[model samples]
Target: MFYRYGRGDEPDLQPTKNWIRRVLLYGAYLDGTRYYYSPDVFLFFFSRLLEENPDSDIHQDTVPLPREHIQKRINADGDAMELAIRILACYSLGIRHKIDLTKQLSLQQEDGGWEIGYLCRTGKTGSRLVNRGYTIALAVNAVGALLTTRALSRNGILIDEGFVESNA
Candidate 1:
């Protein structure tokens, strides 16, 4: 799907084309491990592909979520990491969102890490656990998104230069 779209060719299955395109373009998928859904992974891979194929038109046009759908998602207080990914995805695809970026920033914990609740299950009883790596990755990506869109500076949010360099 990624190659076909980069080549400006559509897949034969029209019905599944959108799904495949989204998965390749956004790295979004259901029922996957937390790592699989990381926005950093999506942005990194997508940007790499674009760099490798400068002539590709994949970035020329993008499929954005419906305005209503995006608004609904933004209004809901769902997973912070997931919401950050959605926000970044919309921003990247040139979708305009009226939602305040501060809401996302507010999700940051006092410990300087974003919570990514229940990244995995452990033990035979299946107790949910938080993964430090996942939390750090999510926080880094969320902040990266804010920086990419210039929201941090525009909103007068000051981040430590060292932190940004290390994460970035």
Candidate 2:
């Protein structure tokens, strides 16, 4: 299906941002069999490298999956909160894929600090861990990524940690 993109042939066009997110979040990791986490790293790079193309017609020839197809990719029993969490996970992964670690770092909520796998599991109320639930490890990882990106962007000069913290 993707081969048609480079051939200059217009295939069916479908633009579903949520599905795109899911493909990047889940399908990218699938090895024609099962899913894995390695795709997260790949996605991080992919998203970071995305250009702001006003004239690009990449999606114009893309085939969009049906809602049922997207529905099957979900594993949280169709719960709205679960779906939201997955989408957030996709954003986190997508930002990383784009290699815009700064964006990933900024995605943190003001309520809680950084941690790894902050929203991986449910808490006391069968709800996923929220930012304010407590300081999780995933948040720390995300924050660290932010710090590193800032330092790099500043050309090895140390940025104000306080400034970074407040911005978060």
Candidate with top lDDT is 1
Tell me the tens digit of each residue's lDDT in model 1 across 1-168: 455454345555444545545765453633343444333334433444444444544444332323223334444454555555555544443343435245556777798776764444554555666665675575566557656545554556743231221211
Q: TM-score for candidate 2, please give it.
A: 0.25
RMSD of each: 9.2, 12.9
Superposition error at 79 for model 2 (Å) = 18
lDDT of 2 by residue, 38-117 (tens): 32333333333232221234333222322222233333232222223333343332222222333444455565543333
Candidate 1 displacement at residue 118 in angstroms? 5.7
The alpha-carbon deviation from the true structure for residue 103 of candidate 2, after best TM-score superposition, in angstroms, is 12
